[model samples]
Structure formats: structure tokens, C-alpha cells
Target: MKRQRAFFHTLRLPRFRRITLPLLLLLVFTATSYSLVGRQTATVPLPGLVMIDAGHGGYDPGVMSNGILEKDITLAIAKQLQAALQARGIPTAMTRDSDIDYADSGTKGSSSKRSDLNKRLELTEIQQATVFVSLHINNSTLATRGGAEVFYSEQNEGTAELAAAVQSELHKIPQMSKRDAKPGKYYLLRNQEIPSLIVECGYLNIADERARLNTADYQKKLAEAIANGLDSWLQKNK
Candidate 1:
């Protein structure tokens, strides 16, 4: 009883009011986060073939919110994801590395969207990707809604499985909720012969989400989650 009372007394310092509470909260959260990550890491399957597509490049801006361009965010997250996967010895491919709209010298790419898509479509011939993932930011008529969503092309069963893996990984994050995978007709998913999924990271229409999407830290987290999902799929499927 005396020892317990002394422990309480130590926490009674004035500094405890300002620092102890926050510190204790941080410790609790950090432990919880670490525990969750360990669980996800164990569950993720690192499949052999992984391909990444940054949606709406070059002539297309994709979605816009508060003037934040979806193309920019997609590319940033895509690159970060690539690094994360590569670090784990997972092979991956990206459709385009530079801004599609302009050349390296800042000259315009294809003037027409149709022509631009035609060029993007040329990527299909490169190689048969085991799984194709198109990265995109979401847009909505309502400004209050936001969250990550995964969609698979109806043409392939593998796509559905891959989407589920990704959705599960995203849910491991602190604020992200588990969104169910659904069927969709995104051309990248439908046209590609390989299993493919499209990830709508978050709705940009919501001001808070848009700001979050624009930050590098959030982008890093997005990549990590994606890599985790793909890794999860690969570990089990391959």
C-alpha cells in the first residue's frame, strides 16, 4: 500500500499535468500500433508479379479538390509504394515515371485525351503483369465523405482476391476503416488480362482528406499500406 501511494505521488508533480498524460497516451498508442503492424506483416503475402499504375497522368488530371491534382498525389504514393515493395524483394513495375502532360523539357504531350490514352494503352504489350493496380484519388458530389475503397474487374477472380488483400491492409491503419471490395469496370482492370485492382485512396472532395492526401507523410503511409496488401496477396497466392 505504501509503495502504491508513493508511485501516485511521483505522478503528482506539476510537470505530470502537462507531460505525463500526453506521454502515457503516446505510449499506449505506440504499443497498439506496433502490435497491429506485427499482425499485418505476418499476414501479408508477397506475390511475385506486381504492377503499379498512377491513375490520370499526362493529359488527365483525374480528380481535383481544393485545386489539389489527383495526378500529383497518385504519382507520389506510387513511387513511395514501389520503394517499399522493392525493399522487401518484391518485384514491381510502374506505367509512367514522369508527368504525362508535359515532356521532360516542359513541352506538351499528346494534345488530345484520346491520343493520350492510346499511348497509355500501349503499356499492355510490355509484359503480362501478375497483378495490376491502378492508384487513384476519389471524388464525390458530397464533400463530407471520405475513405479508401478497392475495386476489382469482374473479368477475373484473382482481381477480387487482390482487392480484398489491399482493403484488409488499409484497414490496419489507425483511422482507416475496412471497406469491402466491389466489382468495377475500370478499363485498366477490365482490359488487362492479369488480375487487376483499382484503389481509390480517399475522396479528395472532402477538405480534410484532400489536405491529408497532399502531405508526404500520408503518402508514405499510403504506399506502405499498398505494399502490405500486395505482399499479403503474394504470400498466400504464390
Candidate 2:
């Protein structure tokens, strides 16, 4: 028992207590903080800045199906996507973080929708974003049509390759339809000088897909897939 007594005596010394107590408290605090946040802090910085746009907010809901608003869903997914990207050490910015729009009523001769779009585009320029990803939910008259689709603007040279990379990653999701990335002429994409694309996450009219889109777990999965795609593209182009 002499060895045990000596060990206990050393632990009780002022110098030992001074160092060990603070370290113990720090360990506890870090554990608590990590548990509360549910995400580890990111340290390394990725190359490009990504601008995420949650399409259609406030008065413009985009599409509504089975009591689900496209604006709400897009915002939810966009926030999740931002988190996912940040977790991977990628820099990200969002056009809207809440249930609001950038439309200015005082702007003469411009429609509210046009004003909102202009504001979103202007923010990208102001932020110097290298890539833009607009998130939206698809609507279809035929409920059977479901699955995520990616469309890139031909205005930028490498946009098609980026879209294809994202689409390929999205296709890996279980039960996700394998859709080819196509060229789109969307105003947001057309106006952007950087690589840009619109991602139609899923069909809101489809019963199963709509149900999945509404759930947090599925939204997280979708965000992870998108993040993975972006990471892949960045790795190749970097």
C-alpha cells in the first residue's frame, strides 16, 4: 500500500492540482460543447467561396403541395447544406437565412420578384463568391415524377463539369433517381460570371419524396450528398 499512498500524495500536491484541475475542466468543457453543438469545429479552409441561394421566400412560396411550402423546405435544406459545407471546412454564404426576401418595394419600375433576384445576384458579386448553388423544390402535375435534378448555366465554362460532379454524387443516394445534369437558362445562373447551378432537390408533388424532404434526417442526408459533390469538384479543380 506504500506505492498507492505515494501516488495519492503526489496528486494532492499544489503544483499537481494547479495543472491537472484546469486540464480536467477543459476536457469537460470541450466534451460538453461538442455534445451541445452536434458538430465538430472546422479548422482548415477550402479554396473557393460558395454562395447558396434558398429560392423563393416570403410572399413568393414557389410551389405548395400537400401542405408543404417550397420556400420553407428550400430554406431548411439550404441551412443544412451550409452546415454540411462548413463541417467540411468549405467557406459558404447564403442569400437568405430566414423566411424573408430581399425585395425592395421602393425600387421603381422593378417587380418584387425581379428586385429579389437582383439583390441575390448583387450579394454574390459583393461577396466575391466563386460558385453559386440555388436550392429549389420541383413541382410536377404527375405525382410519379420525383428525384433531384441539377442544371448548370452554359454562360460559365466549367459550370457543366461542376453540375455533373454534383449530379453524380446525388445519384449515389439510395433510391435517388439517376438524372443527368442539363443546361439551364435560369436568370440567376445566366447572370453569374462564376460557375453556377440550380439544384431541384426533389418533387414536392410526389408523396414519398415530399415526406422525405420534410424530415430533418433526410434533409441532412441530402445536404451531405451535395457537400460531398462540391468537395469532389473542388478537389479536381484545385
Candidate 3:
């Protein structure tokens, strides 16, 4: 019994734990480091970078109707879209991740908006992005219009195809009425340097549509649709 007690006491020594703890930590660290290194080496590079623009942030709340602000909705969708793309190993860059605009607050509102847009244009150029998607919610004095629409610049090559690809997936959403992708002369789209599109996710003027757009579940669906469209288009082009 004394021998057994002595052995058990030896097992409980502080020195034993100090030695064993370091060994255990070393083993864990080695395994984790190896796994991370393997993953980094194995991961494939994306076909190209994608630029995501969340429309009308900061001072520009965009189209506001009822209680819904278009800026909030666009930002929410843009965040989700960015996550969805990143999860698929695609690289993405965002113009504004927060409520603030890209331009200095001291500037006049019109100049601020222009400056914000110019900053976005600069980012697209600097990154040499393969394509740019701008998220927006539509509104009108007439409260009856509601649907997902994609707008592309006629001057930009492959924008029509990009718009069509995204619109097709968005149409799958039951709440969204099918609308054809159309030519738009919007400032964002008219940049012919790269393929660019403005996606009007839904009409905020319509009560039902506004409520749906405000929901997280619906925002996720919209993000997924956009991601799918982008993946399809990119794969085909590759």
C-alpha cells in the first residue's frame, strides 16, 4: 500500500505536469501549423477578383419609402453577397463596408456623392476587378411596382451577359416578378473600363416587397441568387 501511494504521489508532481504540458502543447501546435500549411498550399486561386459596390450609403440613404431605407437594405445584401462569394474561394472587394460614404464629410452632398463614386471607380481600377456589381433598391411615386431588375451599360462589353445571368437567378425567387435585364445609362454602369452592372434588388415603394426585403432570410436568398449567377457566368467565360 505504501509503494502504491508513493507511485501515485509521484504521478501528481508539478514537474511532471510542467514537462507533459509543454510536450502536449508542442504536439498540438505542430499539428495545427501543418494543417494550415497544407490548406494554404492546396487551395486554388480564384479566376479573378470581383468588386461589390453597395449603393448610396452614408448621407445618401438612397430610395426611402414607408419606413425602409434603401441604403440599409443594399448594405445588408452586399455583405451577404460578399460572404457568399468568399465562401466559394472567390476574391471580392467592397466599396463601403460601413454606413459612411467614401468621400470626406466636409464636401457638399452632390460633390460627396460624386466623390464616393469616383473612389469606387478608383478601387475597381486598382484591383483590376473582373466585374463589378452594384446593389440598389428601386422606388417610385407609384407604389405598385415590385420586382428584381438588373441594369447594364450598353457601352460595356459583357455587362448585358452579366445582367442576364444575375437576373435569371433572381427570377427564381418566388416573391420577385420576372423582369428582363435592360440597358441603363447609370453612372456606375457607364464605366466601360470593365464589366459593370447595377442590380435593383426590389422596389421599395411596394409595401409587401419592402417588408420582404427587410427580412434577413430574404436578404440571404437574394445574396445566394447573385452568387449563383456570378459563378455561372464566370465558369462559362472561363
Candidate 2 lDDT, 104-206, residue by residue in tens: 7554334767888987897677556778999999998874768899999998888888999889889888888777899998889888899998999999888
Give stretches of model 1 more than 4 Å off.
Answer: 1-47, 101-115
Residue by residue across 1-238, what tens digits does model 3's lDDT show?
1111000000011211234678767654654211221222112222446778888877679989877889999989998998888776566777667676666556776787787788778766755577889999999866476888998888866778888999999999987888899998888877647778889999987888889999999999999999889877776775
Q: At residue 53, what lDDT does model 2 achieve?
A: 89
Residue pairs that clash (backbone atoms under 3 angstroms), model 2: none
Off by over 4 Å in 3: 1-46
Please list the residue runs of candidate 2 whose C-alpha ends up more than 4 Å from where it truly belongs after superposition.
Answer: 1-46, 106-110
lDDT string, candidate 1, 1-238, tens digits: 1111000000011111234678768655654211221221111222364667777775578888778999999989988987887776676666666566322223244434444444444443342356778889989886466789899988876767788888888887666645788999765666767777889999888777788899999889888988888877777776
Indicate the residue-level lDDT of 52 in model 2.
87
* Global Cα lDDT for candidate 2: 0.77
Tell me each candidate's TM-score. Answer: 0.72, 0.78, 0.78
Rank by lDDT (best first):
2, 3, 1
Instruction: Give the clashing residue pairs of candidate 3, or none.
Output: none
